[model samples]
Target chain A: MNDKLVTVLADVFGLRREQIVPQLTKDDVGNWDSLKQMDLVVSLEREFGVELEIADIITMTSVEKINRILKAKGVDLEA
Target chain B: MKLDGAVSLITGGSKGLGLAIAHRLRAEGARVIVADIDNVALEALPDVFDRRSLDVTQPDEAKSTVEAIAAMYGRIDVLVNNAGVIYSEPLVNLMNPDGMMHSYDRFRQCLRVNLDSVFIMTSAVVEQMVLRRTKGVVINISSISARGNEGQTAYSAAKAAVNAMTVTWSKELGRLGIRCNAVAPGFVDTPSTRAALNETIIKHIEGLTPLRRLGRAEEIAQAVVAAIANDFLNGTILDVNGGVTI
Candidate 1:
């Protein structure tokens, strides 16, 4: 599950893949402001090839929640 | 993006420059929706355009209008922020016995109509574009007065703000594949231009321009089409003023 998601988060937040975890949240990241939130949305949508609703985008505050939303959208995070 | 079959919403499209833009976009094979505050003018428009009565300064109304258009069309490819007023008043008027300074109320009204309307409409339209994953375009109608025109404090400020917002949005939204641009027209030969400035002032402006004439509404519309046609032309303030600055 951490393969592509970790890479995307790392690229967006300027962090390492090892630093990204399911429990990691916006509060834990220094650059996770509203602007970064948009960057994260763009990256996630492009990487997963899935269109996210506004509600889904707003609720994706943590890595775990992002995984859940992507899974619900039929994205195989594990693969 | 190509204009053919593109869904475009233009504010203040019932008359003047906005109407010209609407016609030009239609000629390019776009599905145009014209929104304006003038209900009578909107009703009088031909059946080719989907016309709506919209006061763009109202945030809630702007949001609902964008939502409705998106719902009906399935997607909105372009938004032209063109609803604005042309106002001219000196910052200070010593000759006037009633008041020496510009009215604060009038200043606020000008900002509400010109600046706030752009913010409201762009916010609503861009939200739908992002949610629907459509790589849209936002074209703002600015004025050469944005560089600072005499006796137009509020108008200049509002248009300058629009220019800044255009560039800022271009940088921020580029990642989402949304382009933001502005067309800053000089004194165009429109009714509003003639109304705002007398014939003498118009002639004076014409003499100042390198092209030795006032710009045409159709020329500004063509610049808008150029902005939309070029995919890499983001964050550009395309001055369509016929070398007035030169």
Candidate 2:
């Protein structure tokens, strides 16, 4: 599950899997604008088979926040 | 998406081309809501359509109306941005020497109706679609004038901008399962068209078109239906002109 999340983040941000750390954030990525954020939302939703609410989407500004939100939504990210 | 039982909204749909599109969508089994600023026209509409008064140029009005529709219908499956005026004015009027150039006030007015309204309404509707996780469709009514028409400076510019926005939104929203496309009609036989052009100019345009006739409003509506039905059709400016190019 962690590898899958990293793969989605890497694909959406156009970075390598090794670079997709939990500390990574919108400010850390040059291309992470509003549009890219939406792309990330779609990617995460598809990769995790989850429907994200607008509030969850807004708060998902970093990898750590995304992991927390997924866990709260009942996605078993720990696996 | 499937049209049956889908909630559809058509702005400026109380009459003319918009009304035609609304009728077609209803025939396809969609729940049709016709919104226009014309109260008289709204009242005159048949009992089949849900009527609402709307000024698409107002952002707050647009947002509230969209929210109301979503609350009532559960979700908005389709949005047809068919509200616009057919304005024509030359960049430079050789006959009117006193004020040879087109008025800036009129230019802004045209943009407000044709361009800004699209932005406002689409933003509101897409917000609902995104929030509800609805796979919605946005159909913008463009014009062949978008390719640039003579003596239609403001109209042409506004439509060109509409086309640009259509493409931009399609790219931005595709992943969310929302589709954006436009129907660019040629000279259609409608009250607005007749009001905008005299018989002589209309005749001249018909001669230029390969079909030697102005397009019917129903035919333009057919194009709108096609745009909605075809799921793969995205970011397209479907020109329903009778082989006329400008």
Per model, the share of native interface contacts recovered reads 0.00, 0.00
Candidate 2: residue B66 lDDT (0-100): 93
Badly placed stretches (over 4 Å) of model 1 are A1-79
Cα displacement (angstroms), candidate 2, residue B95, comes to 1.4
Task: Give per-model CA RMSD.
Answer: 23.9, 23.4
- lDDT for each residue of candidate 1 in B133-246, tens digit (9 for 90 to 100): 999999999999899987789999999999999999999999999999999998899989988876656776888999999988999999999999899999999999888872
* Whole-model lDDT values for every prediction: 0.91, 0.92
Tens digits of per-residue lDDT, candidate 2, B1-246, equal 778898999999999999999999999999999999999999999999999999999999999999999999999999999999999888765334467678999999999999999999999999999999999999999999999987899999999999999999999999999999999999999999999986756876898999999999999999999999899999999999999998
- Native-to-model Cα distance after best TM-score fit, residue B194 in candidate 1, in Å: 0.8
Q: Give lDDT: candidate 1, residue B216.
A: 88
DockQ-based CAPRI category assigned to the predicted complex of candidate 1: incorrect
Candidate 2 stretches greater than 4 Å from native:
A1-79
